[model samples]
Target: MRAIWKGAVSFGLVNVPVRLFSATENHDVQFRQVHEKDGGRIRYQRVCSIDGEEVPYSDIAKGYETSDGRMVILTDEDMKSLPSRSSKEISIEKFVPSEQIDPLLFDKSYYLEPEKSSVKPYVLLRDALEKADRMALVTVAIRTRMTLAVLRVREGVIVLQTLLWADEVRQPDFGVLDEDTHATKKELAMASSLVDSLAGDYEPDEFEDDYSEAVEALVESKIEGGEVKAPEAAPEEETEVVDLLAALQRSVDAAKAAKRGGGTKDEAEATPEKKKPAKKATKAKKKAS
Candidate 1:
Protein backbone atom coordinates (compact mmCIF):
# COMPACT_ATOMS: atom_id res chain seq x y z
CA MET A 1 0.00 0.00 0.00
CA ARG A 2 1.04 3.54 -0.68
CA ALA A 3 2.16 5.59 2.25
CA ILE A 4 -0.39 8.20 3.37
CA TRP A 5 2.20 10.48 4.90
CA LYS A 6 6.01 10.70 4.96
CA GLY A 7 7.32 12.14 8.20
CA ALA A 8 9.87 11.74 10.95
CA VAL A 9 9.10 10.62 14.49
CA SER A 10 10.84 13.01 16.82
CA PHE A 11 11.52 12.61 20.55
CA GLY A 12 14.39 14.02 22.56
CA LEU A 13 16.70 14.78 19.67
CA VAL A 14 15.97 11.43 18.01
CA ASN A 15 14.36 11.79 14.62
CA VAL A 16 13.42 8.63 12.78
CA PRO A 17 12.34 8.97 9.18
CA VAL A 18 9.17 6.95 8.83
CA ARG A 19 6.30 6.55 6.42
CA LEU A 20 2.71 6.31 7.68
CA PHE A 21 0.32 3.78 6.13
CA SER A 22 -3.29 3.14 7.01
CA ALA A 23 -3.57 -0.01 9.14
CA THR A 24 -7.28 -0.60 8.54
CA GLU A 25 -9.37 -0.80 5.37
CA ASN A 26 -13.06 -0.19 4.87
CA HIS A 27 -14.83 -3.14 3.19
CA ASP A 28 -18.38 -1.82 3.39
CA VAL A 29 -20.27 -1.75 0.11
CA GLN A 30 -21.06 1.75 -1.03
CA PHE A 31 -24.16 2.97 -2.85
CA ARG A 32 -24.85 6.20 -4.70
CA GLN A 33 -28.05 8.15 -4.88
CA VAL A 34 -29.88 7.80 -8.20
CA HIS A 35 -33.18 8.70 -9.82
CA GLU A 36 -35.45 5.73 -9.22
CA LYS A 37 -37.90 6.34 -12.11
CA ASP A 38 -35.37 7.01 -14.90
CA GLY A 39 -32.42 5.18 -13.34
CA GLY A 40 -30.37 8.33 -13.95
CA ARG A 41 -27.48 9.36 -11.75
CA ILE A 42 -28.45 12.09 -9.27
CA ARG A 43 -26.47 15.30 -9.42
CA TYR A 44 -26.16 18.03 -6.83
CA GLN A 45 -26.20 21.71 -7.63
CA ARG A 46 -24.65 24.66 -5.81
CA VAL A 47 -27.39 27.26 -5.70
CA CYS A 48 -27.73 30.61 -3.99
CA SER A 49 -30.55 30.43 -1.46
CA ILE A 50 -31.37 34.13 -1.77
CA ASP A 51 -31.30 34.35 -5.56
CA GLY A 52 -32.68 30.87 -6.33
CA GLU A 53 -29.99 30.49 -9.01
CA GLU A 54 -27.21 27.99 -9.45
CA VAL A 55 -23.83 29.51 -8.61
CA PRO A 56 -20.38 28.66 -9.93
CA TYR A 57 -17.62 27.41 -7.70
CA SER A 58 -15.80 30.76 -7.96
CA ASP A 59 -18.70 32.46 -6.13
CA ILE A 60 -18.31 30.34 -3.00
CA ALA A 61 -16.60 31.75 0.09
CA LYS A 62 -16.43 30.73 3.74
CA GLY A 63 -18.57 32.71 6.14
CA TYR A 64 -19.42 32.63 9.83
CA GLU A 65 -22.68 33.78 11.37
CA THR A 66 -22.63 36.50 13.98
CA SER A 67 -25.08 37.19 16.83
CA ASP A 68 -26.56 40.10 14.83
CA GLY A 69 -27.66 37.82 11.95
CA ARG A 70 -24.82 38.94 9.73
CA MET A 71 -22.20 36.82 8.04
CA VAL A 72 -18.46 37.52 8.32
CA ILE A 73 -16.86 36.43 5.07
CA LEU A 74 -13.34 35.03 5.23
CA THR A 75 -11.19 34.75 2.15
CA ASP A 76 -8.84 31.90 1.44
CA GLU A 77 -5.88 34.13 2.25
CA ASP A 78 -7.40 34.99 5.62
CA MET A 79 -7.64 31.28 6.49
CA LYS A 80 -4.07 30.77 5.30
CA SER A 81 -2.89 33.54 7.61
CA LEU A 82 -3.79 31.52 10.71
CA PRO A 83 -0.72 30.02 12.38
CA SER A 84 -0.52 26.24 11.94
CA ARG A 85 2.22 23.65 11.98
CA SER A 86 3.06 21.54 8.93
CA SER A 87 1.78 17.97 8.84
CA LYS A 88 5.29 16.57 8.47
CA GLU A 89 6.27 15.54 11.99
CA ILE A 90 5.16 13.17 14.72
CA SER A 91 6.18 15.11 17.80
CA ILE A 92 6.34 13.01 20.97
CA GLU A 93 5.39 14.89 24.11
CA LYS A 94 5.50 12.22 26.83
CA PHE A 95 5.44 8.51 27.55
CA VAL A 96 2.71 6.83 29.58
CA PRO A 97 1.76 3.25 30.41
CA SER A 98 -0.62 1.82 27.80
CA GLU A 99 -2.94 0.47 30.49
CA GLN A 100 -3.59 3.98 31.79
CA ILE A 101 -5.18 4.97 28.51
CA ASP A 102 -8.90 4.42 28.04
CA PRO A 103 -9.71 2.28 25.00
CA LEU A 104 -12.46 4.70 23.94
CA LEU A 105 -9.96 7.52 23.42
CA PHE A 106 -8.33 5.70 20.49
CA ASP A 107 -9.86 6.49 17.08
CA LYS A 108 -7.72 5.11 14.25
CA SER A 109 -4.42 3.28 13.77
CA TYR A 110 -1.68 3.62 11.14
CA TYR A 111 1.38 1.54 10.50
CA LEU A 112 4.77 3.27 10.71
CA GLU A 113 7.59 2.05 8.50
CA PRO A 114 11.11 3.32 8.96
CA GLU A 115 13.23 4.58 6.08
CA LYS A 116 16.12 2.29 5.26
CA SER A 117 18.67 4.50 7.05
CA SER A 118 16.45 5.01 10.10
CA VAL A 119 15.75 1.38 10.94
CA LYS A 120 18.08 1.41 13.93
CA PRO A 121 16.29 4.19 15.77
CA TYR A 122 12.88 2.75 14.84
CA VAL A 123 13.74 -0.65 16.30
CA LEU A 124 15.31 0.99 19.34
CA LEU A 125 12.16 2.94 20.11
CA ARG A 126 9.90 -0.04 19.47
CA ASP A 127 11.97 -2.31 21.74
CA ALA A 128 12.26 0.34 24.45
CA LEU A 129 8.52 0.94 24.51
CA GLU A 130 7.79 -2.80 24.52
CA LYS A 131 10.17 -3.36 27.43
CA ALA A 132 8.90 -0.38 29.40
CA ASP A 133 5.24 -1.22 28.76
CA ARG A 134 4.73 2.39 27.76
CA MET A 135 3.41 4.25 24.75
CA ALA A 136 4.54 7.59 23.44
CA LEU A 137 1.89 10.29 23.39
CA VAL A 138 2.46 12.28 20.23
CA THR A 139 0.73 14.94 18.17
CA VAL A 140 0.64 15.10 14.37
CA ALA A 141 -1.31 17.19 11.93
CA ILE A 142 -3.34 15.32 9.31
CA ARG A 143 -5.40 17.14 6.75
CA THR A 144 -5.92 20.51 8.42
CA ARG A 145 -6.27 19.43 12.05
CA MET A 146 -3.70 18.38 14.62
CA THR A 147 -4.60 15.16 16.41
CA LEU A 148 -3.37 13.52 19.60
CA ALA A 149 -1.90 10.09 18.95
CA VAL A 150 -0.28 7.16 20.73
CA LEU A 151 2.86 5.56 19.31
CA ARG A 152 3.41 1.95 20.30
CA VAL A 153 4.85 -1.29 19.02
CA ARG A 154 2.55 -3.84 17.41
CA GLU A 155 3.98 -7.17 16.26
CA GLY A 156 7.51 -5.78 16.03
CA VAL A 157 6.32 -2.76 14.04
CA ILE A 158 5.56 0.77 15.18
CA VAL A 159 1.90 1.77 15.05
CA LEU A 160 0.49 5.23 15.60
CA GLN A 161 -3.09 5.38 16.83
CA THR A 162 -4.97 8.66 16.82
CA LEU A 163 -6.72 9.58 20.07
CA LEU A 164 -9.48 11.92 21.01
CA TRP A 165 -8.75 14.65 23.52
CA ALA A 166 -10.03 14.16 27.05
CA ASP A 167 -12.27 17.22 26.72
CA GLU A 168 -13.95 15.66 23.72
CA VAL A 169 -15.56 12.98 25.91
CA ARG A 170 -18.79 13.81 27.73
CA GLN A 171 -18.97 13.24 31.48
CA PRO A 172 -21.30 10.47 32.62
CA ASP A 173 -24.01 11.70 34.99
CA PHE A 174 -25.37 8.74 36.93
CA GLY A 175 -27.70 11.02 38.86
CA VAL A 176 -30.32 10.46 36.21
CA LEU A 177 -30.41 6.74 36.99
CA ASP A 178 -32.75 5.44 39.71
CA GLU A 179 -30.77 5.10 42.91
CA ASP A 180 -33.49 3.88 45.30
CA THR A 181 -33.15 0.28 44.10
CA HIS A 182 -30.30 -1.86 45.42
CA ALA A 183 -28.97 -5.28 44.44
CA THR A 184 -28.67 -8.02 47.03
CA LYS A 185 -25.25 -9.40 47.91
CA LYS A 186 -26.20 -12.87 46.64
CA GLU A 187 -27.45 -11.48 43.34
CA LEU A 188 -24.29 -9.43 42.83
CA ALA A 189 -22.09 -12.37 43.68
CA MET A 190 -23.90 -14.64 41.27
CA ALA A 191 -23.64 -12.06 38.49
CA SER A 192 -19.92 -11.74 39.12
CA SER A 193 -19.52 -15.51 39.00
CA LEU A 194 -21.40 -15.69 35.72
CA VAL A 195 -19.14 -12.99 34.26
CA ASP A 196 -16.05 -14.91 35.40
CA SER A 197 -17.29 -18.12 33.80
CA LEU A 198 -17.86 -16.35 30.48
CA ALA A 199 -14.51 -14.52 30.49
CA GLY A 200 -11.96 -15.68 27.91
CA ASP A 201 -9.13 -14.38 25.73
CA TYR A 202 -10.14 -11.68 23.25
CA GLU A 203 -10.01 -12.98 19.68
CA PRO A 204 -11.34 -10.48 17.13
CA ASP A 205 -11.35 -13.11 14.38
CA GLU A 206 -13.95 -15.12 16.29
CA PHE A 207 -16.57 -12.43 15.75
CA GLU A 208 -18.11 -11.19 12.48
CA ASP A 209 -20.51 -8.58 11.14
CA ASP A 210 -23.51 -10.86 10.80
CA TYR A 211 -25.77 -8.18 9.32
CA SER A 212 -23.26 -7.36 6.57
CA GLU A 213 -22.83 -11.06 5.79
CA ALA A 214 -26.59 -11.54 5.44
CA VAL A 215 -26.90 -8.47 3.20
CA GLU A 216 -24.07 -9.72 0.97
CA ALA A 217 -25.72 -13.13 0.71
CA LEU A 218 -28.99 -11.56 -0.36
CA VAL A 219 -27.25 -9.43 -2.95
CA GLU A 220 -25.36 -12.45 -4.31
CA SER A 221 -28.59 -14.41 -4.63
CA LYS A 222 -30.25 -11.61 -6.57
CA ILE A 223 -27.21 -11.29 -8.85
CA GLU A 224 -27.27 -15.03 -9.58
CA GLY A 225 -30.96 -14.91 -10.68
CA GLY A 226 -32.01 -16.83 -7.56
CA GLU A 227 -35.22 -15.81 -5.80
CA VAL A 228 -34.42 -14.04 -2.54
CA LYS A 229 -36.92 -14.81 0.18
CA ALA A 230 -37.42 -12.82 3.33
CA PRO A 231 -36.17 -14.78 6.29
CA GLU A 232 -38.58 -15.41 9.15
CA ALA A 233 -37.54 -13.54 12.26
CA ALA A 234 -37.25 -15.53 15.46
CA PRO A 235 -39.87 -14.87 18.12
CA GLU A 236 -38.64 -12.74 20.96
CA GLU A 237 -38.33 -14.50 24.29
CA GLU A 238 -40.68 -13.18 26.96
CA THR A 239 -39.17 -11.89 30.18
CA GLU A 240 -40.26 -13.78 33.29
CA VAL A 241 -40.87 -12.05 36.60
CA VAL A 242 -39.38 -14.07 39.44
CA ASP A 243 -38.04 -13.54 42.93
CA LEU A 244 -34.58 -11.97 42.87
CA LEU A 245 -33.01 -14.88 44.75
CA ALA A 246 -34.51 -17.48 42.41
CA ALA A 247 -33.46 -15.55 39.31
CA LEU A 248 -29.91 -15.29 40.59
CA GLN A 249 -29.81 -19.00 41.37
CA ARG A 250 -31.12 -19.86 37.90
CA SER A 251 -28.52 -17.58 36.28
CA VAL A 252 -25.72 -19.23 38.19
CA ASP A 253 -26.92 -22.70 37.21
CA ALA A 254 -27.25 -21.69 33.55
CA ALA A 255 -23.76 -20.23 33.53
CA LYS A 256 -22.30 -23.36 35.05
CA ALA A 257 -24.04 -25.62 32.54
CA ALA A 258 -22.89 -23.50 29.62
CA LYS A 259 -19.31 -23.52 30.87
CA ARG A 260 -19.36 -27.32 31.32
CA GLY A 261 -20.80 -27.85 27.84
CA GLY A 262 -18.08 -25.69 26.30
CA GLY A 263 -15.36 -27.42 28.29
CA THR A 264 -16.57 -30.87 27.31
CA LYS A 265 -16.62 -29.98 23.62
CA ASP A 266 -13.15 -28.48 23.86
CA GLU A 267 -11.72 -31.47 25.69
CA ALA A 268 -13.23 -33.92 23.24
CA GLU A 269 -11.67 -32.06 20.35
CA ALA A 270 -8.30 -31.69 22.09
CA THR A 271 -7.91 -35.32 23.19
CA PRO A 272 -5.76 -37.50 20.97
CA GLU A 273 -7.45 -40.59 19.58
CA LYS A 274 -5.91 -44.01 20.06
CA LYS A 275 -5.13 -45.61 16.71
CA LYS A 276 -5.36 -49.42 16.64
CA PRO A 277 -1.95 -50.81 15.96
CA ALA A 278 -1.62 -52.62 12.62
CA LYS A 279 -2.72 -56.25 13.01
CA LYS A 280 0.13 -58.74 13.18
CA ALA A 281 0.83 -60.15 9.71
CA THR A 282 -1.12 -63.40 9.33
CA LYS A 283 0.47 -66.37 7.66
CA ALA A 284 -2.65 -66.73 5.51
CA LYS A 285 -2.38 -63.10 4.24
CA LYS A 286 1.26 -63.67 3.24
CA LYS A 287 0.31 -66.85 1.40
CA ALA A 288 -2.51 -65.01 -0.53
CA SER A 289 -0.10 -62.21 -1.50
Candidate 2:
Protein backbone atom coordinates (compact mmCIF):
# COMPACT_ATOMS: atom_id res chain seq x y z
CA MET A 1 0.00 0.00 0.00
CA ARG A 2 1.19 3.54 -0.72
CA ALA A 3 1.64 6.10 2.04
CA ILE A 4 -1.20 8.65 2.06
CA TRP A 5 0.80 11.31 3.89
CA LYS A 6 4.40 11.95 4.90
CA GLY A 7 5.14 13.69 8.19
CA ALA A 8 7.08 13.60 11.45
CA VAL A 9 5.76 12.63 14.89
CA SER A 10 6.95 15.29 17.35
CA PHE A 11 7.24 14.64 21.09
CA GLY A 12 9.45 16.31 23.66
CA LEU A 13 12.71 17.21 21.87
CA VAL A 14 12.50 14.21 19.47
CA ASN A 15 10.90 14.14 16.02
CA VAL A 16 10.57 10.83 14.20
CA PRO A 17 10.05 10.98 10.46
CA VAL A 18 7.25 8.60 9.43
CA ARG A 19 4.96 7.77 6.55
CA LEU A 20 1.19 7.47 7.19
CA PHE A 21 -0.87 4.76 5.46
CA SER A 22 -4.52 3.88 5.88
CA ALA A 23 -4.87 0.61 7.75
CA THR A 24 -8.41 -0.31 6.70
CA GLU A 25 -10.47 -0.62 3.52
CA ASN A 26 -14.11 -1.19 2.69
CA HIS A 27 -15.27 -4.40 0.97
CA ASP A 28 -18.99 -3.75 0.76
CA VAL A 29 -20.84 -4.58 -2.43
CA GLN A 30 -22.06 -1.71 -4.56
CA PHE A 31 -24.73 -1.50 -7.27
CA ARG A 32 -25.57 0.90 -10.07
CA GLN A 33 -28.95 1.89 -11.48
CA VAL A 34 -29.71 0.52 -14.92
CA HIS A 35 -32.65 0.00 -17.25
CA GLU A 36 -34.14 -3.44 -16.63
CA LYS A 37 -35.39 -3.93 -20.21
CA ASP A 38 -32.19 -3.11 -22.18
CA GLY A 39 -29.68 -3.41 -19.31
CA GLY A 40 -28.31 0.10 -20.12
CA ARG A 41 -26.45 1.89 -17.32
CA ILE A 42 -27.93 5.11 -15.97
CA ARG A 43 -25.82 8.26 -15.47
CA TYR A 44 -26.43 11.70 -13.99
CA GLN A 45 -25.38 15.11 -15.29
CA ARG A 46 -24.99 18.42 -13.51
CA VAL A 47 -27.74 20.69 -14.86
CA CYS A 48 -28.53 24.24 -13.80
CA SER A 49 -32.15 24.93 -12.88
CA ILE A 50 -32.08 28.58 -13.96
CA ASP A 51 -31.41 27.96 -17.68
CA GLY A 52 -32.25 24.22 -17.65
CA GLU A 53 -28.87 23.56 -19.26
CA GLU A 54 -26.04 21.18 -18.47
CA VAL A 55 -23.28 22.97 -16.59
CA PRO A 56 -19.61 22.46 -17.40
CA TYR A 57 -17.45 21.17 -14.54
CA SER A 58 -15.16 24.21 -14.67
CA ASP A 59 -18.14 26.61 -14.38
CA ILE A 60 -19.17 25.33 -10.97
CA ALA A 61 -18.13 27.30 -7.86
CA LYS A 62 -18.82 26.92 -4.13
CA GLY A 63 -21.72 29.06 -2.98
CA TYR A 64 -22.71 29.91 0.58
CA GLU A 65 -26.37 30.69 1.04
CA THR A 66 -27.22 33.41 3.58
CA SER A 67 -30.28 33.45 5.86
CA ASP A 68 -31.89 35.94 3.50
CA GLY A 69 -31.63 33.43 0.63
CA ARG A 70 -28.79 35.18 -1.20
CA MET A 71 -26.02 32.99 -2.56
CA VAL A 72 -22.44 34.27 -2.26
CA ILE A 73 -20.23 32.52 -4.79
CA LEU A 74 -16.71 31.81 -3.61
CA THR A 75 -13.86 31.36 -6.08
CA ASP A 76 -10.61 29.43 -5.67
CA GLU A 77 -8.83 32.61 -4.64
CA ASP A 78 -11.53 33.36 -2.06
CA MET A 79 -11.24 29.82 -0.61
CA LYS A 80 -7.48 30.28 -0.28
CA SER A 81 -8.12 33.40 1.84
CA LEU A 82 -10.00 31.35 4.46
CA PRO A 83 -7.99 30.21 7.47
CA SER A 84 -7.05 26.50 7.53
CA ARG A 85 -4.35 24.52 9.21
CA SER A 86 -1.87 22.47 7.17
CA SER A 87 1.12 21.05 9.01
CA LYS A 88 3.79 18.48 8.20
CA GLU A 89 4.00 17.29 11.81
CA ILE A 90 1.92 15.14 14.17
CA SER A 91 2.42 16.90 17.49
CA ILE A 92 1.90 14.76 20.58
CA GLU A 93 0.07 16.53 23.39
CA LYS A 94 0.18 13.99 26.23
CA PHE A 95 0.00 10.31 26.99
CA VAL A 96 -3.16 9.05 28.67
CA PRO A 97 -4.53 5.66 29.69
CA SER A 98 -5.64 3.76 26.60
CA GLU A 99 -8.93 2.75 28.23
CA GLN A 100 -9.94 6.40 28.67
CA ILE A 101 -10.47 6.83 24.91
CA ASP A 102 -13.88 5.48 23.87
CA PRO A 103 -14.11 3.35 20.73
CA LEU A 104 -16.76 5.69 19.32
CA LEU A 105 -14.26 8.57 19.10
CA PHE A 106 -12.15 6.58 16.65
CA ASP A 107 -12.78 7.48 12.99
CA LYS A 108 -10.01 5.94 10.90
CA SER A 109 -6.76 4.14 11.67
CA TYR A 110 -3.38 4.58 9.91
CA TYR A 111 -0.05 2.83 10.34
CA LEU A 112 3.03 4.97 10.99
CA GLU A 113 6.25 3.66 9.50
CA PRO A 114 9.50 5.34 10.50
CA GLU A 115 12.15 6.59 8.10
CA LYS A 116 15.49 4.72 8.06
CA SER A 117 17.29 7.41 10.02
CA SER A 118 14.49 7.84 12.59
CA VAL A 119 14.03 4.13 13.48
CA LYS A 120 15.81 4.47 16.82
CA PRO A 121 13.58 7.27 18.11
CA TYR A 122 10.49 5.57 16.72
CA VAL A 123 11.35 2.38 18.63
CA LEU A 124 12.07 4.46 21.70
CA LEU A 125 8.60 6.07 21.65
CA ARG A 126 6.87 2.79 20.90
CA ASP A 127 8.64 1.06 23.76
CA ALA A 128 7.76 3.88 26.16
CA LEU A 129 4.08 3.78 25.19
CA GLU A 130 3.91 -0.02 25.50
CA LYS A 131 5.59 0.00 28.90
CA ALA A 132 3.30 2.67 30.25
CA ASP A 133 0.10 1.05 28.81
CA ARG A 134 -0.91 4.43 27.38
CA MET A 135 -1.84 6.14 24.15
CA ALA A 136 -0.48 9.48 22.99
CA LEU A 137 -3.04 12.15 22.19
CA VAL A 138 -1.98 14.03 19.08
CA THR A 139 -3.17 16.53 16.47
CA VAL A 140 -2.42 16.51 12.75
CA ALA A 141 -3.73 18.27 9.67
CA ILE A 142 -5.06 15.99 6.91
CA ARG A 143 -6.20 17.11 3.49
CA THR A 144 -8.31 20.23 4.17
CA ARG A 145 -9.13 19.61 7.85
CA MET A 146 -7.39 19.09 11.19
CA THR A 147 -7.94 15.81 13.04
CA LEU A 148 -7.55 14.66 16.63
CA ALA A 149 -5.79 11.33 16.86
CA VAL A 150 -4.29 8.90 19.34
CA LEU A 151 -1.01 7.05 18.83
CA ARG A 152 -0.90 3.54 20.16
CA VAL A 153 1.33 0.55 19.53
CA ARG A 154 -0.31 -2.40 17.83
CA GLU A 155 1.35 -5.58 16.56
CA GLY A 156 4.83 -4.00 16.86
CA VAL A 157 3.73 -0.93 14.90
CA ILE A 158 2.55 2.51 15.86
CA VAL A 159 -1.09 3.02 14.80
CA LEU A 160 -2.60 6.50 14.61
CA GLN A 161 -6.39 6.43 14.96
CA THR A 162 -8.21 9.66 14.18
CA LEU A 163 -10.97 10.74 16.59
CA LEU A 164 -14.17 12.74 16.47
CA TRP A 165 -14.63 15.85 18.63
CA ALA A 166 -16.99 15.75 21.61
CA ASP A 167 -19.64 17.87 19.88
CA GLU A 168 -19.79 15.42 17.02
CA VAL A 169 -21.07 12.66 19.32
CA ARG A 170 -24.79 13.02 19.76
CA GLN A 171 -26.23 12.69 23.27
CA PRO A 172 -28.43 9.60 23.38
CA ASP A 173 -31.60 10.93 25.00
CA PHE A 174 -34.47 8.83 23.76
CA GLY A 175 -37.16 9.05 26.44
CA VAL A 176 -37.68 5.27 26.47
CA LEU A 177 -34.30 4.73 28.22
CA ASP A 178 -34.72 7.53 30.78
CA GLU A 179 -37.64 6.10 32.77
CA ASP A 180 -37.06 3.64 35.57
CA THR A 181 -36.38 0.29 33.92
CA HIS A 182 -36.28 -3.05 35.70
CA ALA A 183 -35.79 -6.65 34.72
CA THR A 184 -36.97 -9.70 36.67
CA LYS A 185 -34.26 -11.50 38.61
CA LYS A 186 -34.97 -14.72 36.65
CA GLU A 187 -34.69 -12.89 33.32
CA LEU A 188 -31.45 -11.24 34.46
CA ALA A 189 -30.02 -14.59 35.55
CA MET A 190 -30.99 -16.16 32.22
CA ALA A 191 -29.38 -13.28 30.29
CA SER A 192 -26.17 -13.57 32.33
CA SER A 193 -26.15 -17.33 31.75
CA LEU A 194 -26.64 -16.77 28.04
CA VAL A 195 -23.74 -14.30 27.92
CA ASP A 196 -21.44 -16.61 29.88
CA SER A 197 -22.33 -19.58 27.73
CA LEU A 198 -21.44 -17.72 24.49
CA ALA A 199 -18.30 -15.92 25.71
CA GLY A 200 -15.12 -16.85 23.80
CA ASP A 201 -11.98 -15.38 22.29
CA TYR A 202 -12.64 -12.82 19.55
CA GLU A 203 -11.00 -14.30 16.46
CA PRO A 204 -11.90 -11.86 13.70
CA ASP A 205 -11.15 -14.41 11.01
CA GLU A 206 -13.92 -16.78 12.04
CA PHE A 207 -16.76 -14.62 10.83
CA GLU A 208 -18.00 -14.48 7.21
CA ASP A 209 -20.58 -12.46 5.30
CA ASP A 210 -23.33 -15.01 4.88
CA TYR A 211 -25.63 -12.67 2.92
CA SER A 212 -23.02 -12.07 0.24
CA GLU A 213 -22.26 -15.78 0.10
CA ALA A 214 -25.94 -16.60 -0.29
CA VAL A 215 -26.24 -14.03 -3.10
CA GLU A 216 -23.36 -15.62 -5.04
CA ALA A 217 -24.76 -19.10 -4.43
CA LEU A 218 -28.18 -18.02 -5.68
CA VAL A 219 -26.67 -16.50 -8.83
CA GLU A 220 -24.60 -19.62 -9.52
CA SER A 221 -27.66 -21.83 -9.02
CA LYS A 222 -29.61 -19.73 -11.49
CA ILE A 223 -26.82 -19.91 -14.10
CA GLU A 224 -26.48 -23.72 -13.80
CA GLY A 225 -30.26 -24.26 -13.62
CA GLY A 226 -30.68 -22.61 -17.04
CA GLU A 227 -32.89 -19.80 -15.65
CA VAL A 228 -30.69 -17.20 -17.33
CA LYS A 229 -29.90 -19.36 -20.40
CA ALA A 230 -33.62 -19.92 -20.80
CA PRO A 231 -35.14 -16.51 -20.03
CA GLU A 232 -38.57 -17.88 -20.84
CA ALA A 233 -38.64 -19.75 -17.49
CA ALA A 234 -40.26 -18.05 -14.49
CA PRO A 235 -37.79 -16.33 -12.14
CA GLU A 236 -37.56 -18.02 -8.74
CA GLU A 237 -37.75 -15.85 -5.60
CA GLU A 238 -36.29 -17.35 -2.43
CA THR A 239 -36.55 -15.63 0.95
CA GLU A 240 -36.44 -16.96 4.48
CA VAL A 241 -36.60 -15.39 7.93
CA VAL A 242 -35.01 -17.16 10.90
CA ASP A 243 -36.69 -16.80 14.29
CA LEU A 244 -34.86 -15.45 17.36
CA LEU A 245 -34.27 -18.89 18.85
CA ALA A 246 -33.18 -20.26 15.48
CA ALA A 247 -30.73 -17.37 15.09
CA LEU A 248 -29.32 -17.98 18.56
CA GLN A 249 -28.96 -21.68 17.80
CA ARG A 250 -27.23 -20.91 14.51
CA SER A 251 -24.82 -18.57 16.32
CA VAL A 252 -23.89 -21.32 18.76
CA ASP A 253 -23.46 -23.79 15.90
CA ALA A 254 -21.28 -21.30 14.05
CA ALA A 255 -19.10 -20.85 17.13
CA LYS A 256 -18.68 -24.63 17.35
CA ALA A 257 -17.86 -24.80 13.64
CA ALA A 258 -15.23 -22.07 14.14
CA LYS A 259 -13.70 -24.09 16.99
CA ARG A 260 -13.41 -26.98 14.51
CA GLY A 261 -11.29 -24.70 12.25
CA GLY A 262 -14.01 -23.72 9.81
CA GLY A 263 -13.34 -20.78 7.51
CA THR A 264 -13.39 -19.62 3.87
CA LYS A 265 -10.47 -18.19 1.93
CA ASP A 266 -9.68 -14.56 2.72
CA GLU A 267 -10.35 -12.81 -0.56
CA ALA A 268 -12.14 -9.58 -1.39
CA GLU A 269 -15.72 -10.43 -2.41
CA ALA A 270 -17.94 -7.81 -3.97
CA THR A 271 -21.47 -7.84 -5.41
CA PRO A 272 -21.50 -8.71 -9.08
CA GLU A 273 -21.40 -5.64 -11.29
CA LYS A 274 -23.86 -5.31 -14.15
CA LYS A 275 -22.28 -3.70 -17.18
CA LYS A 276 -23.70 -2.82 -20.61
CA PRO A 277 -21.88 -4.99 -23.11
CA ALA A 278 -21.10 -3.87 -26.67
CA LYS A 279 -24.05 -4.01 -29.07
CA LYS A 280 -22.97 -7.19 -30.89
CA ALA A 281 -21.76 -8.96 -27.76
CA THR A 282 -24.95 -7.99 -25.89
CA LYS A 283 -27.00 -9.38 -28.75
CA ALA A 284 -25.01 -12.60 -28.84
CA LYS A 285 -25.17 -13.03 -25.06
CA LYS A 286 -28.90 -12.49 -25.02
CA LYS A 287 -29.41 -14.77 -28.01
CA ALA A 288 -27.27 -17.51 -26.48
CA SER A 289 -29.09 -17.13 -23.16
Best by lDDT: 2
C-alpha lDDT score of every prediction, in listed order: 0.83, 0.85
Candidate 1 per-residue lDDT over residues 4-116, each given as its tens digit: 89999997899999999999999786666755654455667788889999776668899999999999999999999987777689999999989998998999999999999
Show where candidate 1 strays beyond 4 Å: 66-70, 178-181, 226-289
TM-score of each: 0.70, 0.72
With a 3 Å backbone cut-off (N, CA, C), the pairs that clash in candidate 1 are none
lDDT of 2 by residue, 105-159 (tens): 9999999999999999999999999999999999999995788999999999999
Q: Which stretches of candidate 2 lie over 4 Å from their true place?
A: 65-70, 217-289
In model 1, the Cα lDDT at residue 107 comes to 92
The per-residue C-alpha lDDT of model 1 at residue 11 equals 71
Return the TM-score for candidate 2, rounded to 2 decimals: 0.72
